[model samples]
Target: MDVREIPHTEATEATEATEATEATQATGAAHAAAADATAAALARVRGAARAGHPRALAWRTERLTALRALLTERQDDLAAALHSDLRKPRSEVDNAEVGFTLREIDHALRHLPGWLAPEPVAAAALGRLPPGAAATTRYEPLGTVLVIGPWNFPVQLLLVPVVGALAAGNTVVVKPSELAPATSALFASLLPAYLGADTVAVVEGGPEETAALLAERFDHVFYTGNGTVGRAVMRAAAAHLTPVTLELGGKCPVFVDRDVDLAAVAARLARAKFANAGQTCVAPDHVLTDPGTGRRLTAELARAVEERFGPDPAASEHYGRIVNEHHFDRLVALLDSGRVVLGGRHDRADRYLAPTVLANVAPDAPAMREEVFGPILPVVHVAGVDEAIALVNGGDRPLALYAFTGDEAARRRLADETRSGAVNFGLPFAHLGVPELPFGGVGESGFGAYHGHHSFAAFSHRRARLDVPIGAA
Candidate 1:
């Protein structure tokens, strides 16, 4: 019989099956190509590192300067890509991603000379040596390293580490997050042009490409994401005995004292929590306050949200959408876990979730179960600072702990009692802007910190050198 003579349903099924098979084959081929490209890039970067091309101060300076220029020259391009990926506002893209990275590059460039200088060891510390003996510690590059970036704040999170790696005079292979495909493609295309193809290579793909890159040996692996993948990165690095710096996120908590300025506290909290659609690593995941304070703060927070995003945030130009449908759905479900006090509207089609505040949230609510990396802010009532401290101590250490209080004793108590990566007295997410502070997590958040001088240290090996006369030893 002729193929046209077949039943309509049967023919449709046959065609669909054939298309599926073809798609599967194509996907396999693409993954294979990505793996091959990653392997080749690693080899090229390693070769460059061995050639000592990146070790020169001049070369490092040129790369840093180029990185800054790239950010400045392509600010609009980056902002557009970020908007495509996360619906990020242009102002946020400028201030948070491009501007943040530019600051890092500038700091590294300005301090590179002083940071690279060898530190002399005291004679008292060098025991059992000749009188003329001297010791010094030099900051040396860790050779070709791999930097795996996260989708949230893709440019800043990924390139900030690159600044340190390059500043430390290391050839680098960067793996941009596949979720942010626009930014990833942009980086893949632009990095080679700006930083040279041989010294710095950008590998673009998802888990497959990352797995392939992880399988290969690297001097150091720097990852910024969650703990699940952070563990995987650690495991892969273990095979090669490679050191890794994991910048992972957890449920950061905030405590609102009844004595503080409710309006100011609410404003800061709203700004920090809702920014980037609440996808920030250090954003306040939940609020702990007394029942009265919770009720009052909820009203203030509602006012703050309206003031920031206007009556209808969905219509606001400054408001952002969720990264994707999965996160959107996850956040939508959390809204049911507590009483919605403010914005709770969401549209899956647009991946938009309003800056929602959940009051009367039970401690064991679904939203409280994990890090709510969305625009859902859960407010749980506590007895006071003691209860807040207890709750914070009970859970895994957070990446940041925020408190709004005028009492010095309360501030000191929170600072002294909590085991977090950072503690802010009256605000949240400000510590990251300070280039001098080390930014990372503790416990489940992840290990290893990086920023400014800390970034240089993370990528460098303090090689100890000893000098003595021929017979002095």
Candidate 2:
């Protein structure tokens, strides 16, 4: 079957309506303020960059060091803000957000000299050149960059790209998600003390502010959010010919083979899917397995959820609540889209939804149609690997894909056939921990990547240099 043959979901319509409603809530005066603030920030960054402040290796290193110190010193404050904004546990905040960011900083600092060094090109390719001729590709900073972060993983998503952009010697404007107001305020307030207010400015507001920011010119734009906002960012960047690296989410799928360890699969899936209330970009959106494997996996998954979040997940301190009422309702609507296998409890007042598993869901089910950025796990039974691949490829490419099997052929087939930002054999979302791996999406999931050298390259331009002999004759 053609990939486009798969039906789209109502979740897209729901998300667009939500985005429109939220974007319009901000007033005209707010838009004016956002535009003025963005303009002023852009000017300051451009001025600083022109003055040769951020270009120095020492300056870049110092700024990265200061950012690390900021995360370390303000860990408590950051965690508290995250809790207030997303109901994320302090431990989750530290491990998933702060720790990951610190690692990125450390990785960049260690390898930045080599990354910035000019790569020598073989002069042999240009036989017409004089004997003294030399060629090299130098990675240079993109002057002023904009980092538009998402509400989920607000701290990490916002500042990780800043780590790369700053390391590449560019001035930055960070626009944190308005959905996470507390974290946004914390970033705007605290970033100045660490990275210097003038060099890295944080603009905190809704879509109007983001739209205003995008209207201005920038050397590079890095955005992490839904496809709707991502398209808007791309359009705005297109007008100015600004390069963009979008990190959008999609319906990441997991294919399970009969030979897998059901218990291990359950533990890994439960940890990844339910973490941060399943608001992760790379989390497994759905599962495809044969009937026997599906039944066994579902049983194991129920036990895994009970083990992690306990019978009353709402009371479990480890589990998080839904980000807000809108998302909570979205998730609630999905529960009805499939047959519940385990844990369907919810509380709208607290914005809580238990780690849920829905079995025997149809391909056209609302929950299966879109990126289910929630704790709802829909297990759709498939005949085998071919069916699973067809079902997955039928939709837009996802940010990540998982196949659980010890068979080498199965792994190879999945790797060869599917398109995703990353593919893994045993677990999900752990690919993000490796700084060496580039993280982002493909197709509808997202475009471009950033992490390690990828981040440096993404934020920097490769300028070709040549030493042309004056006596060319």
Candidate 3:
């Protein structure tokens, strides 16, 4: 509100100080004065979004409509950036990162109207009111949105939420992780030109800049990263009283039932583990299979990893490197407690680590204790599904859970007993392969859901509106 709108008085015999005055001010004027400064700024963003102005909506039907074309046109650029920064392959880029993101753009464009439409109500509550009353719920924009994305899958982590914000009629400010400098810069440069600056703005920096952005009041905040930073983001959002949806990493578990298909499990586990060198948040941290099954899986996965990326990830161009030696050393130090069953080689200069899977790991071992985001998968042997569920629930809730089984009853039991936000049955790692699922975490893994419609709703406020029939009598 302006100073004139504050109901201020000049100091004199005629002017009395309101702070010390015991007299009452007009309620309407008091409400106007109490209106937060951020309300107007947020309103402007909502207005811009509603207008779908050329400068505001930016990409609109053109980029949203031609997402595949744009991605195909710029495929080399994206792949090159990921390779330069993360050491991923051209094929991996198209299938994992670019593939799903472009698909999300297309999916959101096609279903955006359904997402944005105000919901209808049954007037159930209105029946309780005196004869002529009625009520209806309305949906609307949350105004300005803040997205704090992670270094791993930096492009998709950031833009996926932006897709939702834009679709739900809101402007977004994306803070891409500085760890992946190349991709971050690429997004900063590419997004604005393709999608205008007014609707979407990318601020490229580290924690300090992120802290500054968090300090600024916003209508909503969506963060994707590790739990430590996610908690800090939550704290900052709380200070501003801003509602946030945090997508954080956890030790997602994978259970292999006795009746499971060993060959298919080996192939699926290998793809998920070595996809980005196992740098993904929902990547399976450890496996719990029967002693017989665990041993077989270990042998099969070793072969699968070798088949997919060859004997040495250091020499394989397909295998990605750790973001830095710090993370490489972190994983290296953790390997001391367990017997290295597969690969454990690391080269600092190349920043390469093999698809290392450790066997005979004790529950208290470092690999089991925390999230091993590297290519190392520790296969922990348990008797059956009950033991596996107990082990999974022993720690905090993971972002994703994978249980491979042909038994229908056992699958439902596993799903019910666990606390993960998402569960995949009959597949080792189902988080990435399925686009229909909403991905997120619970408890320490983090809160909020994203992907498809779940994300579109995350950046919007579910406005509880009531419409009363004027003369129903």
| Winning model by lDDT | 1
CA lDDT, candidate 1, residue 106: 88
- Candidate-wise lDDT, in order: 0.91, 0.90, 0.77
TM-score per candidate, in order?
A: 0.95, 0.92, 0.85
What is the overall TM-score of model 3 with all chains considered together? 0.85
RMSD of each: 2.2, 10.7, 12.4
lDDT of 1: 0.91
Stretches of candidate 3 off by over 4 Å are 1-63, 66-70, 123-125, 128-135, 432-435, 469-472
Q: Per-residue lDDT for 275-365 in model 2, tens only?
A: 9999998889999999899999999998999899888888888999889999999999999888898888899999998899998899999
> Comparing candidate 1 with candidate 2, which one achieves the higher lDDT?
1
Candidate 2 displacement at residue 410 in angstroms: 1.3
Number of clashes recorded per candidate: 0, 0, 0
Per-residue alpha-carbon lDDT of candidate 3 for residues 262-357, written as tens digits (9 for 90 to 100): 888888988887778889887878888877888888888888987888766677768888898889899889888578888888788888878887
